[model samples]
Target: MAKLEIVSPVTGSPRDVWASLRCAAEDAARDEPQLASQLNSVILSHDDLSGALSFQIARKLGDSELGAMTVREVALAAMQADPSIVRSAEADLLAVEERDPAIRSMLQPFLYFKGYQALQSWRVAHWLWEQGRDTLAFHFQSRISELFQVDIHPAAKIGSGVFVDHGTGIVIGETAVVGDEVSMLHAVTLGGTGAERGDRHPKIGRGVLLGAGAKVLGNIQIGDYAKVASGSVVLKPVPSGCTVAGVPARLVNCPTEAAPARTMDHTLADVVYDYVI
Candidate 1:
């Protein structure tokens, strides 16, 4: 099989990312002797990004219907077949590392973050969906939901550099489109308002920050650099660079930050708090 090559959108190549992960794993193993075997198998034993990712994700998602080795082979093949998958995966790793304060190194997300793992698995499932393998795609989705408690439809279009923090209870509808650099917290839903068939879900633009428990429903557009406050129910189009809040969300004010998603800021101004509709 041909090797998978990834070029990071932020900085470095696939080899660089893999080397960093390996070094981190080695340091972690030395620091914590009990977990040496697990770390070695998951990171140090693999030769490349694809191999390590394949093993880690497969181990988490695999079950009786499909063994770990079988799932690993599938993930590896997908990564090899589509170079973009590797690129996206790399971008995701960087995104998580840069944005999450708790993340100490690239290896942390690569080895133990369920959000990152679930997203990568979703990428493979999305690939299968594009290849007319809907049944297999759905199976992967099922496994992802079972393992991560995050339910993203196989048909949802998610862009790179996206971060799903505290990923449990996050749902993306089949027609939802999440753009690059979007950050969403747990219990968020990009859903449809009703049983509308085609193009029913929301279109989330780049650099958008969705606070925890936010529900964006119907066929609407969330403009780039927009921020949706936690527990807000957004039913209409949110303008670019603005912040929205409340049950049927209203524009609170324009955010000061250029890209609120990158900053991961959840603070709303006191004036805006009083402006809730």
Candidate 2:
């Protein structure tokens, strides 16, 4: 794991400069009283956003051997910043952790984690949603997905350990249930078939992997350890320990055929930006 350097607010300090203006960036709300008041109107919305950001930091710290900086400290750092500032911090931390090779070598999760980036996006969207600004939240989320190729619904329920590789065009339904150790790639869809009102969409099991362009619609149960191939549209219950492919995906192989998880290529040098809490 990479060493957690304690940055200082001032330069030329013995310890690393852990406290910088980057972490203390101000928000647009500072100049806009109406926006600030609007955000505060939501009960405890700021605190909720903080907690969500904290959760992502903790997940990123999973089992890493940092010298002293703990996940809690990351959350604390996030909390100290204004909500808008925290949003950028969360994105910076995620962008570095998820795609930066320099930091990847220093972090254990560089090779095997997913939820760090996903959760950060979710928290930002959730904060915006709470503030009654769904359009802005979704806009930010869409941009993240477009740039990172990792598509996660702003309203989806996601657990930790989600690895979304080549995430371009990945679509998660609003009513989807994602569990731990789940991995999906470009163009995968956990969506609904028709205009069903109540409880439409797939119910994904824990530790499942959906290949690129795989579409699982309706209220179907994709059992644990299930894998769906690219371009497959599943409308039936996929039993545990099975790999399904093609339209209306059916069981083709058993769980023993489950392949090892892989990481996505993050070599593109585009600027990655996300909304702050």
Candidate 3:
């Protein structure tokens, strides 16, 4: 997703990240004695990212409906059946680390960032949805919405290396297809134009950046590396490597950066708009 996928200090496979995460957790424990128990329970106790994430997700989403142990089992089952879930989680961690300025280590996203947490939990829910377990999947969706303030339908197909920054108020529709290396800020909505069914949401291409408060409605194709400016309402298809801005988004810049999501830049170029305010 980044310029370097297997480089040192960032963007490696799950095993490499897991090793670093454990080391970071140990370092944090030594630095802050107060959080030693919390760090050990969440990170040191687990053997891998899948195990750690399952435990963490259960702790966050568990309730009276299903105890934390049961939630952890469900998550573990999903990840065990499909190893890609853990791989996606690793890629997501890298995405957050590389894209967000506030991120200090992979441990931060794994333990604290609600965007990463919510997205990973949704992956489990998505697996459940695919298994024809709608009731349980809806339960996850509801809980995720309530806890994280991010509502993503279980049927959404999100790719790895996807970063959802400040995930509050983010709503992804059922048929939305987010590609790899995509990044979106808070209040971004991938929704339909009207009440419809069957492939109605946006098909976001790889390496796209959807700025804060951007609403991309209808069955639109956001081509790879396209950027939707903040507060823009995009109703039409955006061409590859283009930047759109305004109420009904218009092309303000084309042939933009090849990987806007990786760069995490949404600054619009100075251009004169023909339409009046």
Best candidate, lDDT-wise?
A: 3
- What is model 2's C-alpha RMSD? 15.2
- The predictions' CA RMSDs to the true structure, in order, are 2.5, 15.2, 3.5
In model 2, what is the error at residue 40, expressed in angstroms? 32
Question: What 10-residue stretch in candidate 3 is worst by lDDT?
Answer: 1-10
For 12-85, candidate 1 gives per-residue lDDT tens digits of: 55545666778889999999999999998998887878888899989998999999998998898899888788
Q: What is the lDDT of residue 125 in candidate 3?
A: 99
TM-score of each: 0.93, 0.52, 0.94
Q: After superposition, how far is residue 31 of candidate 2 from its true place, in Å?
A: 40
**What is candidate 1's CA lDDT for residue 226?**
95
lDDT of 2 at 177: 83
Q: What is the TM-score (0 to 1) of candidate 2?
A: 0.52
| Candidate that beats the other on TM-score, 2 or 3, i.e. the better one | 3
Candidate 3 C-alpha lDDT tens digits along 104-171: 78888888889999999999999999999999999999999999999999999999988999899999
| Per-residue C-alpha lDDT of model 2 across residues 1-277, encoded as one tens digit per residue | 1212332212323331122211221232355466554323321232333443454444443343431235445444535543543444333333333333434221223223343454454555555555566785576466556545556566666654455554556677777887655667667788888877777878888767777778888888888767777788788888785667666565556543443222332121133221110
Preferred candidate (lDDT higher): 1 or 2: 1
* Candidate 3 collision pairs: none
